[model samples]
Target: MDRVKLITIPKIEDTRGNLAVIEKESIPFEIKRVYYLYDVPTGAYRGAHAHKEQSEFLIALSGSFEVVLDDGIETRRIMLNKPNIGLFIPTMMWRELDNFSSGSVCLVLASDTFDESDYIREYDKFKLFKST
Candidate 1:
């Protein structure tokens, strides 16, 4: 029941600023889709569900936020405030994104396309699924 983990990507530094790169080799899974969450209202929350099969890597492109992960038995909280770091969220784990600062941008690199059948949106049902 391993929860989410922070992944450090290759960061190239220069006088201009810094750049981080995430390739297929850097992540555990092959990325099939890329999406980002931004313009979140102050103190708002997102990602109140869990994926059944799809895995994802989350990065904070700007500003900061926190992710709450639950694996039916234990819960953990991870803060995302750096663009060079990302969070790898495996399947069958519940995740919630909250405590978003203003102008925060959360980028997500997914392992699969959008599939409604792969999502478990209810906490009770997710717990039941884990019991099996």
Candidate 2:
């Protein structure tokens, strides 16, 4: 919803493999947690929630997928495919992942550890919370 920053991480290409690294302070926030979503069936969606404090960077590692971001009042869609690019989601922005390709892998980097209180899972509740 609010202006989120999307950064494209540079990929180091090699004869054997490619690598992309994220160091502390390299991004807007420090790295506190990491997670990935995989084995998601086609037409299935994920991540219909918003965070209170956590900032996230999402990457499509294997296949292409669409990330729908809503900032309560407005919405935007982002297409992710390359491993070197990542979407930086600011706090309080609602997000949803959809149009996942087969064998798609979505990786997420977080700025905070798991805290139940930071999550706002309901859209209406998130809208109300953001307005205040």
Indicate which candidate wins on TM-score. Answer: 1
Q: For model 1, how does the per-residue alpha-carbon lDDT over 1-132 read when each residue is reduced to its tens digit?
A: 464779898999999999888877899999999999999998789998999999999999999999999999999999999999999999998999999998999999999999999999999999999999
Question: lDDT of all predictions, in order shown?
Answer: 0.93, 0.90
Best-fitting candidate, measured by lDDT? 1
Candidate 2 CA-lDDT value:
0.90
Off by over 4 Å in 1: 1-3
**Model 2: per-residue Cα lDDT at residue 56:** 94
- How well does candidate 2 score on lDDT at residue 119? 96
Q: Give the RMSD in angstroms, all C-alphas superposed, for model 1.
A: 0.9
